[model samples]
Target: MEVVATLAGMSSSRTEALTPSQVRSARAALRALGRAGMAECDVDGQWAIRADASAEHAQSSATAYRCVHDQVVEERCEYRAGGVSQWSVQQAAELKANRAREQAWWDGLEAPERAERRRARQEEFAGLSVVEQERVKIELAERRVRAGVDEAARHDAWVDGHTMDAWVRRSIERQYRYQRLPEPLQQAKAAAWQRHRERFGIARGTPLATSRREHAAALPSTAAGRDEEFLLVDSGGRTTRRDVETG
Candidate 1:
């Protein structure tokens, strides 16, 4: 069962409303009436009464019961009545209808009117000098070009290189000795060396041989693959030799 209550000290007039204590008493009475299966009733200028009644009669009696109940409870509770604004169901319905009508009126406008408004905005923009328009266009073009270049660079970096396997082989060969490398690795190393020399503008003939020789001379005497019996003489006249092997 549902119960409705009227606050006490609340004015029956919309301008001033009932007090909290009055509302509490009203709520309690409504609750009791609901539990007892009785509807609250009121006669003008009399105390509120609870009675067993039909639903329709109960609903109709609520207004009168609320008015008398609020007055009596407010008097007994000595509570201050507060102001309230009231709106009828009809008034609320009218407000909603007015809003919907306004929205529909806006929606009913012709496409041409909307287009005209858009064209007016465009005309305002077009009224700017030609040089300003050109400047704006140029800025937009530059921004697009920059964005295109950045996208292209990102795409290129993401692409897998066609020569990645060959490059890996060359790298392995460089780490190990070329003579000890497998046939495929050896070819890769040679290709890599030629490519490097070409990139650095080095001649592929005698000059490259001389460079390799000079590189070999820089290695320590104890380093592998050098002739062990060979001697190196320093500027101070000190001589060093590779140790002889005996079997």
Candidate 2:
């Protein structure tokens, strides 16, 4: 069961929003509500958390939110356990609708428009300061590393006979997660994931193509067929087959 908690209106009417510490405290409290299985929170529910004034006030409000969230969960537990819960049904429907809408929007874009958008994004990035550029680069690299690790885990799971449904679910979960990031970070994550896919040769219908190629390449060459002692075996999956000079 996935729990969605919204820190509703953390900002305030004041010129300045809540302090960083207060925001963190409030987020932590919201996570606690999620951990305790508050499946869905009402945006205008009877309970409210007004935390823009001070950190102490934010903490108190967070505690109050948690108490109310817990009570709501407890009240709904029996209905949730017995059959299809309203939250699950509603969430699934929303997800399906959102995906359809997004796909339609993407499909409606022309090639020239897409290319122009990409060029504009490149220009925007090039216009950033050196420090900002470095930050973006570092974030992109980290995302690629994370994606590689996740791909390896997925490959292992597939080898161990996990269902294809699990793989699809994991991918959808990742998509939903990065889509929620701020625009720049979201683009970086998406590009990193795209590069990860290319590195692993994950085509539309063949996710394991590169793995199979690497496995075939890893075998000793037909010309070098012998009881050769293996000193170092480096399987450069992306490079397929390359002779390494070992001194």
Candidate 3:
């Protein structure tokens, strides 16, 4: 007769609910070919009892690694717990072993070989574009910042040669922060930008004009007659008004 068990309370009083720890004990009993009243069990809270079943049938789904004192056992025995597959367990074990072996091999390498490897990696990095290099630097810096090894900065002397305030001002001048900047910062940045344009003629359809228009439009209640001062002057010293379209 085939009998089964599950996490759900057993239907018959003769069957007892087994804890995860009891799985191996039950499996050992089932594997003993001549053992009487033994039940074939799996780690997935499942078991079966058969009057005509043999030890081979009981051990077919078993792993070659054994679980010892609830610790993992390596080689020729199966670790059986929590329904974890033997193949997956073996793969993890092998990966860990391989990492150790690789570390040992690397440690045994000659100084020259290690130096050459470092030089090769440096060369590969040197081949990247300036923009790509800057991106890598920012990513590394951000990682360092997250690890508390460094403080986050918008720019560094070697990276962009601009301080955070300068970067924000530049972003505003480039129209990248027209609507994004705080109202006060936007007005201050716009005033500073207007001074720059007066000193150096504001070109039509440029970031300066676009940002000014956006700033004015965003605060129409306060921008009455304020936008009139933003006039584009040509090389001939004549003022020409041009509407710069926002993208």
**Top-lDDT candidate index:** 2
How would you encode candidate 2's per-residue C-alpha lDDT over 1-247 as one tens digit per residue? 0011223455443344566666576566665554444323457643333333455655777999999898778659857678656666786677667657866887899989988988998898868854576567557545544433344445444554534434333333444454556898777756765665566554433445444445445545433321121222223221112343434
Report lDDT per candidate.
0.49, 0.53, 0.48
Model 2 misplacement above 4 A = 1-83, 118-208, 211-247
Candidates 2 and 3, the one with greater TM-score: 2
Q: Report the Cα lDDT for residue 133, model 2.
A: 68
Q: Tens digit of lDDT per residue, candidate 1, span 1-247?
A: 1124323333454444556875567666665655545644355422344556567656767978999898777555543344322333455566557657866876788989877877997787567554555455446444433333333333234332324433333333333344455788567646654554443343543443344445544544342433221223223332445322321
TM-score of each: 0.17, 0.27, 0.21
- In model 1, residue pairs whose N, Cα or C atoms come closer than 3 Å (at least 3 residues apart or on different chains), thus clashing, are 7-23, 8-19, 8-22, 8-23, 9-18, 10-17, 10-18, 10-19, 11-17
Q: Candidate order by lDDT, highest to lowest?
A: 2, 1, 3
Model 3 residue 102 lDDT? 69
Model 3 agreement with the true structure over 1-247: per-residue lDDT tens digits? 1122232233243365565555554445445633533455468746565566555645652433233423444422443434655667686677667657867998999999999998998888768754565556556554544433323232222234544334333433344325546888667656654553343343333444355455535532223222332222223342444432221
Q: Which model, 2 or 3, shows the larger lDDT?
A: 2
Scored against the true structure, residue 61 in model 2 reaches a CA lDDT of 78
What does the lDDT come to for candidate 2?
0.53
Q: After superposition, how far is residue 216 of candidate 1 from its true place, in Å?
A: 7.9
Give the number of colliding residue pairs in candidate 1: 9
Better of 1 and 2 by lDDT: 2
Question: lDDT value for candidate 1?
Answer: 0.49
